[model samples]
Target: MAENMTGDIISDHRERMLNLKKYYPFFRLIDTSFSNFKDGKYEILDMGYIVMAVLRFFIEENNFKEKDVTYPEYLDFLRLILKRDFGLDLNEQDSKEIADYIFDKIKNDGRPFEFSYFDPVDRKKRVSRMKIIESSIRDNTVWYSISPDAIEFYLDTKEIKDESRISVSQLLLEKMINSQNFRGGVEVVERINEEVNRLKLKKNEVLTILSGDVFAGIEAYEEFVKTGMKWFDDEEKLFKKNRDLIAKSIEKLNASGSTGEGYYRTMNEIYSLETQLKQAMNRHSELLKDCTEMQKMTDDAVRRAKLGRLRSHMDFTSALSDMIKRDNADILVTMLSPLLKPNIRKTFDLISIDDALMVKPPRYEEKELISNERPEDIEFEDEIEEKRIKDNYVFLMKNLIVCLKKSDIITLGQFADAMKRAYGEQILRNADFFSFFVNLCQKDEYQLGGDAGEDTFLDAYLGEGFKDTESFTFAIRKGLGGQVILSDNCMMADVELVRKEAHGE
Candidate 1:
């Protein structure tokens, strides 16, 4: 009965292997209990069939109708099956070999097993049935199991031909090259080239791998390209808008009619003041010349008197008379009584009589000097000083008008320099004149007063103030240095003043 029970178990194992093949064409039963029993040995079940059954269930469930599975997923499926069905913890290497055998059978034959089922009843009735089932299962199963080294061989060969890695690598390379980050793109292409070369892959195989990713890269590249195009369009629009605004501002400036006459008036005023200043300077030079000439005459007269004294013991009467006439005898006599010689009077009287005789009567050569007007020959020092001061004030007014016409901002330092340039050292001494200049320049009628006094405005407009008195002094000392000439509109009133000054009206 024990022998019979053993035979029954073996027959059942054979039937089970056949059924497993029909359901899972990708997996094959290698060795079963029946085959082992035929060799007169009974081994305890390892339940490898349970692993296969669960894997078959998974494949059917996921609708994986493929004839063959690749290495990685196949190995993973085997491990999953083992864990699910038998709770057997198989290591990675063991699971991989089992999966490899299954893959090989499916790849080669399109099916895992040669025999479909075993007839246990027929084995009892006909010995041939037992032999047939055992032979078919053993040959197919043991063929895979005998050389387990074949699994590794198959995997090494199959992995080389797997195009998935190559496909993904190619996709990555294409994406990187089209990316905006140019450096990163170059790096990715280099890495792809190195890897492809290292793998010893054929050009066609590499190209095929790369093809799949091309479309994906193109999609992303299109989006990036559009973004850049839009940015350029936006910039162009902004530029046009700004250009139009500037054009409008220029048109407005042209439409206003205040500029031309204003500019002319301001320029004329400046020129008139300049003329007056020149005249004052010339007068001062003339006075200096006269003083020098008078000093020379005095020296000559003294020398003549000394020479005459040596020539004549008669008290040098001719030299004394000449000296008194040259020195304004009447004033000298009153101012320097102690220095006057007693003989100087007698000599002066004789010289006076000779002067009266030599002086021709005025023929009234159309008296150049009018009775009410001062003579050109007579110079009044006080009047010259007053004219100089007036010229300086007029010059400052002219500058202020020009600056206002131009819509130019004049800083405090610039204003001060203008004053100094117009009036020289006199401006520094006259606080009232400085105050008047500031008040006049800042008037709305002059159009010189804007928001220029505000600290924020000044900081933005004027770069920085003079660092020291030397810079300020240097700025004011020259012809153009202190001038803050403005536009035509601002200088109109000043220009009118200049015209009046020119005609002396």
Candidate 2:
């Protein structure tokens, strides 16, 4: 029975695991189960919460494109948040010290956080490293942003606004784009590009190892090739397929011949995506060639190492063992004394030895009063707003389906008119209506799989109104329609909706 259950489970997730491993180091800082060097130093009240607070701050600052996020601002934020969130009233000096310590961990002390793990897919060791946040030199001072890996890691936890109709992609980046989940498609490709970067870094690691230690380098090179070369053929084919798809999309846009503002805006975004995709493709190709050459170079090194290629320095341990074997006990101490000598340094103690005698005895200590009563369940504004929007989604979908039932194909203009007639003109002005436009553009295509079936989040969000209608496949188009003037404040590019069976597709 256990084997039957296990048989249904999909276990090989090396690609997903590789993506997830990027965040392991960041969380490793706060995990009590794992030992970190700074664990003692960062032992603050709710250390994990504070760490997340700092990470969220970085993400928000980057979102706002703030160029002036320096240490002073960070210190100020730390001071205020500690007081507000945890009621830890710390002095200025102490606050600065804590802020500086946290900043170091967030930046990983200007070095990449590194880790190695065995990938189950290929049964090979894979090296993964990422900095949670990175800094840039701007005007001789540093400014920071959340690193790409961290951004991807954060995004991984978020569900797509419209729960993917099928799967986001059962396969690759191109399929994702084709599914009309545009941003997800772009980000998915970015992750693949990151995989290429990791492989390149792995190759360089092998070369660096080889330069110092021949045997270790040879082993590392073999492992690197084994992991990297796995994707060599698939990635090459994927790059071409994606680029061709992009070209086809571009062609479709040009073929539309619409000179609307929305048309040009979408064209510009596609152009930018095209440029980035080309760069990633080029980098991936070059990395493949470099890995192949490195493999050959490493093979040569292994051959030389087998022939007893010696490093520049003599092996100290081997020499010591030989001496001991020869029974040269008298000279052993003489030879080892200098190496084993205690590390020499100079330092002065801040506290004098005599001060210990003058230390006062402990008196009665008063602790802060603790409240035993259960705290009220907090309701966040974001959560409230999300709830409001989701409710809006249910109502809007209900009305839209009603309109679609009147006619097999419904255009945005038609739907808006029906909404204004059924509800009120004010409904057209609602932000929920505007948000629907945004989601539609992201995933302009949708269809009901069957009666009483909820294939996508859209179907579920449609409420009981959806189950009342028969099965249908509907797609919205931005290119074919003119501007949809729903309200004075809210205007959207005219979107045309067509049913799947109408075109016999």
Candidate 3:
């Protein structure tokens, strides 16, 4: 019974392997290399070298365009590669023999093991891309070319060179533009989504790594800042261009009155692009905002860590406690000499002042002890406190708006820095005021308030921060250290006030 069970297990395993091989045929070509197997082992070798040779031939000789090679040409090329790269001398061997050997080796190849994957689209166990060989004949001359599937495998495994990556975003945009065709539109959307997901994952990874450790090298921090800023700038420009294209497309679609299928298709494509563009733009904004927040958090963490270290080194609390325990009060007094009053020489005797001792009982008026007493004329303390906070918020908001108006754009960090510098720490260090400023920046209306009338909405007419001191309120705007520029929609307008308008001066 045990033998039967073992046999059944083996048989099931064999069946699964067969299924995997059936679904993915490219596995057969993988084990073609003579070096992949050891001596006396019943195993197929790796044949990836042959694929590499084929690719090299096309790339080095520019034969990809030709797409075909004669029987003799193929043999000569393989013979030359073996001689040059593998140090094999096939000169004495017949060309026909070499060709037959290569063909037999390629056709009879098997993989090291069965590889399979679950296909979501087909909802079944599926194989990856396969079929690594393509050959044909015409008029007694055999021709050779890598099959499309083989080409795809090559591309998938190859590394993309830096030059090829110079305009990756541009290429994606082009692909999205051309994906209006029925066959590829879905794929294009999937690709875009995949890229966006990758970016989000990368951002998360960066934040996680940064959060885990605070004392990164200066060079690492510098590089991150530089690269991050550049990335934002470049992506922002690309998004703007995409927005313009979508806007124009929408306009064109609206103007055209044709009810043809082509028209409808184009319209559908335009809508799709619009949606994609919006998502991309939003993701871009999210990444920048997240980066900004992460930077602030990292800075705070590092500062705190440094401060903690400093306190550890400079701590004198234990010493003071020890002094008190030992009754070393005299030493403590000397140590605190700077804070103690200085001793002075006696200038007069206590008896000399006896004649000047006339002390009139201080004239006292009837006064009320006002502890815990309700006063009808005064506002409640809680109400007063709430009013103060509200007033501070209003003041911060007006200043922020004025700062934004003075410049076309500014980042939240820049605004914060400006607030600290111009107004001093009196307002920026206030938690409530800072929160109010951040809230204003997040408003949809304020974001779109870069336009003419919108930009001036937060002017002096609405708040006292813009009150004229001289000829105009010197609107203090913050600059963003030349790294990130605020989006036009989020920028506030700096407003100037004239005294004549308020009191009819």
Candidate 4:
């Protein structure tokens, strides 16, 4: 015979099943408690409730300082609970015997509750063992507390929630630290990190949905905000509080001036626990930062989807029909301005001066006047050209700000379409649209709130105090691959304008 070793047919079958199998022993232990064929099928009624109550008591006791929960105290508590709830009245000797019997079953007769499971990862059967409650001997008195595994098992018996996991894990880590269970603290922090990473992936999924459908994405995002993001601040405070507690614990341990295997081992576990907590905190912070970015991404996507996308744009079909009806093709120049050409210039040099002298010059071209007084300010053709470029830059920035106001993200292809619809198709013929973008890209990000800096061309609106723009902050970058067809003469690489999200937003 050969072995058939294919992976999970349903993917995660092994993981989910393994998790479920971990609870099997606990359920069976409760069901078969003190039941024996030799004794003619004796069983404890309400054994499940009693077991759960016992676990809760152990956890709550451990949370307090030196509660010293002992076996005799346990017997007394059990006696009271049994009499109150189960209506069982027994003598002191009978109570002790019943307590010992329950204790033996819970402790698996001084052995761990063990089970074997198939480890898909290792392709082998492995044994997992755990104690529902653990005991410690102090001054010849045994102290009992709930184990971390048992606490987690208790939590799993309820509904599975996303945010509850992180919050509950933090509380568990705190409990583990309080009980000096540093090794358990490491596992708790790891679980916290996994939850944070899961949220990060969820953020990306929401953004992807946002890109395609605004209404649906907004609904999903609102739900996400309610569930996970709402508790981010509170969770961060908990992280800091726990970190400080761990630091103080390490200091206290070192101050005890102890030296031995137990002391050093505890010291090493404390340091390891601190390192895991720090990593978890850093991961949590990164998730928060990513979430802030997602807020901007979602807001812009919704607004753009609502306002930027149009149902009607330039009707080139009707315009072309009219052009043909008028029996003139020159109208094609304005209508087909998407493929406009650059201006061609010709000048006469010294070699062509003789030929140029043969042509007559125009007479009386508005009779130039010579003034004796120098003008307050003189602007030449060069100065006029510079002014025109500046004015075009300002105008382009105003429209760019308009897009920025509507949305934080706009691609060049999208902006070009907007300009063609609002300003007219001829605007694309001007070189200034692309030129302004070039200057903006060179200047990088422009902050709109502050006073105008040296990069006056792109940031000029700052000094101008443009209304509705002061709230905006912009960054320009090379866009995802594509080309913006400016004209038949040239094509520009697509650019993306991103409004940078303010910190703490």
Residue 16 of model 1 has an lDDT of: 56
- lDDT values, one for every candidate: 0.38, 0.66, 0.50, 0.74
- Tens digit of lDDT per residue, candidate 2, span 191-267? 55565566666777888899889878878876765556664675566567677888888788789898999787777
Question: Comparing 1 and 4 by lDDT, which wins?
Answer: 4
Candidate 2 achieves a global lDDT of: 0.66
| Global Cα lDDT for candidate 3 | 0.50
Winner of 2 and 3 under lDDT: 2
Q: For model 3, what is the alpha-carbon lDDT of residue 264?
A: 79
Candidate 4: TM-score? Answer: 0.43
Candidate 1 has what TM-score? Answer: 0.15
Candidate maximizing lDDT: 4
| Candidate 2 global TM-score | 0.32
Tell me how candidate 1 scores on lDDT. Answer: 0.38
Give the per-residue lDDT digits (tens) of candidate 1, residues 451-495.
333333222222122112121100111222333333221111121
Among these predicted structures, which one has the highest TM-score? Answer: 4
Q: Across residues 409-502, which tens digit of lDDT does each residue of candidate 4 receive? A: 8999899999999989788877677667766777667766445465754566334545444555787777568998876665788888887773
Off by over 4 Å in 4: 1-25, 33-129, 134-145, 155-160, 259-265, 305-505
Assess the local accuracy of residue 39 in candidate 4 as a C-alpha lDDT between 0 and 100: 66
* Model 1 segments more than 4 A misplaced: 1-48, 51-55, 61-69, 101-505
Q: TM-score for all predictions?
A: 0.15, 0.32, 0.32, 0.43
Q: Which ten residues in a row have the lowest lDDT in candidate 4?
A: 1-10
**lDDT score for residue 486 of model 1:** 33
